[model samples]
Target: MRVFVCLFLVSVLGCSLAEGKVVSKCDLKKEFNNLPESEWPEGHTMTDNFLAKLICHVEKASEFNTSAVNQLIPKKKEEEEAEQWTLYGLFQLSDHLICSDGATPSPDRICNVTCSALVDDHIEDDISCVLNIARKVIDGGFAVERKREFWRMVKLIFQPDCNNETAGNYFAECKD
Candidate 1:
């Protein structure tokens, strides 16, 4: 009986650890609310829609294919060719142009620029694009520190091989 009980306990603990800790929408909401108003991104509010998008992004990130992670890297356009933007590029540009000012850009500006740049022709509206970009900003460690911390959190979270040191390597490689 003692051996059986010990085995059962071990199995239970193993299962719980394997499942990992799930960061739910409610948890995110609580965290957002706890933050001071000054920390809220410009033009962003803690709305139901925002929460849904955030949760969706997080869920998707967990299931994302690490092998295909390279596809997220934006390709460069030739001088004569029209500018093309990948999801990665749009996120980077938004951080550099708008968020770098210490205030997040309005949704309209981000949506227009990022949505327009997406290589996928099917997506017409910028809502998803905006949400994803916002997620990148929030998770990319941009808002964490006043200055410094440019690591891409999404890449780190999704790609097992990508950590803090390698988080933004894709951007660097693409630039070169």
Candidate 2:
């Protein structure tokens, strides 16, 4: 009985101990490399420099926090009455396509994971989910469009810091 009770307490409380955090840039550089070489959308593959861009994008998107949330405020009056979309987790993924807040009616949850789950400490699944998004081809459907939009929204080319020309800057400070 004592052993069982202790196990139950640990099972209940252990997960609660995991919290969101702002991860380090070099740590992310190492983590991004763990993703196996895979096909990305638009016929692109995961090149080495692509990994740097990804780390940089994650840096700008969520500051590496598992709990970051970007509430996308609509600029148009027509969209004011519509449900606001949100970006969740380290990638700043959209609730409109990647997650559902549980309260909102999401007809387009591609990741099919809960928004809360995306904000948790176990991010291997989150990384896999985004990778799955990257692997999708241009299918000419809403799902693929949303996936394209995810890349567009997070694309770093326009950003002066981590754009194509400056992506390597994100890892300049860290040593292997």
Candidate 3:
């Protein structure tokens, strides 16, 4: 009985370790409620699928065929200057995911559209890092013209880093 109990405990611990933490927009809302709206970034174009596009770009750029490009674009977590990401990038990212042409999607929209998909796919990574960036960019105090400048930097980072001509097309839009 003692040996069986020990084995069960070990299995339980292992399972728990294998399961990582998950963060969602709902969680963000609960945590950041007291924050002011001006601090929020405003890049959500309503019609542009920013999140979907970014995801597709990241996924494709990270694949074996284009992994070289992925290597060139540093992971958000790895940068020492990660905290310095401008509000424009954040708003652009959020707007891409939640906006439907200036009509920002509610928390429920996020939960229904992407969160449900995340749960269904069993994705475990804390994508909230990017989401938070989006939130901050939208809510942060940066002005619209400054936001455009920030996006220019993002575009510069992607242009030379991408080896795939097709992926280059996406980066090109940033120029306009």
Which 10 residues in a row give candidate 3 its minimum summed lDDT? 64-73
**Clash count list over all predictions:** 0, 0, 17
Best by TM-score: 2
TM-scores of the candidates are 0.28, 0.69, 0.27
In candidate 2 the C-alpha lDDT for residue 12 amounts to: 64
TM-score head-to-head 2 vs 3, winner: 2
Give the TM-score ranking, best first: 2, 1, 3
Best by lDDT: 2
lDDT of 1 by residue, 15-45 (tens): 5434333444344445545555544456666
Q: lDDT tens string, model 3, 34-81?
A: 344543345543122343354344434332111021112223545454
Off by over 4 Å in 3: 1-48, 64-126, 141-153, 157-176
Model 1 TM? 0.28
